[model samples]
Target: PPGFVSLVGAGPGDAGLLTRRGAERLRTADVVLYDALVDPAVLALAPSAHRFHVGKRAGRPSVSQRAIERLLVRAARAGKRVVRLKCGDPFVFGRGGEEALALAAAGVPFEVVPGVSSAVAAPALAGIPVTHRGTSAAFAVVAGHAEASYGPVLDGLAPGTLSLVVLMGVGERAGIAARLRARGWAAETPAALVLGASGELVHTWRGRLADLPGLALPPDRTHLPGTLVVGAVAALSLRSPHSTEAQPAARADARPT
Candidate 1:
């Protein structure tokens, strides 16, 4: 019998956010290669599978991308049902596309099971909608893992763009804010940092764009993955009144047009 691979999105950080299809793939996996940030509960879904950690983080040792692709091909060719579990939508900067292409080139059977991206979920979980009727109607999502990659996105961004969502950006928050300001973005533009989104330890910080560089995380969580949101909507939180998450205060100062 032949084997197959499924690139499953694990969602932001909560196991509950895993899609029905993603869950189904995990339940049938004979071998699971999961990212570093996948929640433990999600891994529990594949109890009988042989699990391997192939997650990557900034400043930490990680399995190389090429190596991971090779592993997937080898596993499938060996007649094992493989699962490449990723956090968030695999295609949303999760490198799922690269892996998929590698599998195709190798003639290995594989499929992508999309998951919720933290770019949108992080802001929503923090009570900030990326778009609102009058507040904002357009947005851009960019990866902040490298300045070379994100610098062009920031430079090409229109002055009137309403919202910007950044993933893997905490380490470069200061540089990003500086570039946005240099591009004529107002210092007082609303901004937010949502850490550990959709998880029990989630925390949100909100203030003017200028305040981003000054915002600090707990020493322990300094390297925690985060989503950075900028523009007027960052100051709005539509979470239920009973929601315990700290909501951003509505901006009293008018945002720049």
Candidate 2:
């Protein structure tokens, strides 16, 4: 019997946000591999399945990408229904493409089940829209871990005209801000950092672009999974007019493990 693989997105941190398709795959999975940031609640859905945690966090030892891919291939070759569950959308910075390619090359039958991405979901959950009429007509989603790749894109953006959503940028907040400023983005541009989006530990910090580096850092200086939103729309949060008044703090659940 030919084995199959399913790459499923678990959504940001909220188990409730997982798609029906993703849940279905989990229920039937013979083996499940999930990311570090995926909520435990979601993992519990595949109670009877063999589970592996292959998630990566900055400054922490993690299962290598190659190892994970190999494991997927091996599991599928064993005629098991393997599920690679990732936080947020599988294709959106989840490295699902690489896994899919590996599966294809290994002749393993596979499918991808998309889930809501933190890029848009994080900001929206923080009450800020990535795009709003007369505020931002376009938005750019960039991986902060690869800022060098965005140099040309950043340089071409017309600052206030385009909203910027940065993922995996909490640690590089200062550099990202400096780079944006160097690219002619205003220091006073509205910016918001949404940490642990859609989870019990969700915390929001809203301020100008100049405040990003400081606001993104907690007193402990530990990096948390966060999404940075910068532009005119970042200032238009529906949560509270006082959202910017609180200094960023780390919640027990939001701390990177």
Best TM-score among the predictions, by candidate number: 1
Candidate 1 per-residue lDDT, tens place, 29-141, comes to 99999999999999999989999999887679999999999999999999999999999999999899899999999999998899989988888877788999998999999
- Kindly report which residue stretches of model 1 are placed more than 4 angstroms away from their true locations once superposed: 246-257
| lDDT against the true structure, each candidate | 0.87, 0.84
Q: What TM-score against the true fold does each predicted structure earn?
A: 0.93, 0.89
RMSD (Å) of each candidate, 1 decimal:
5.5, 4.8
The worst-scoring run of ten residues by lDDT in candidate 1 lies at: 248-257
Candidate 1 residue 181 Cα shift, in angstroms, is: 0.5
Clashing pairs in 2: 36-55
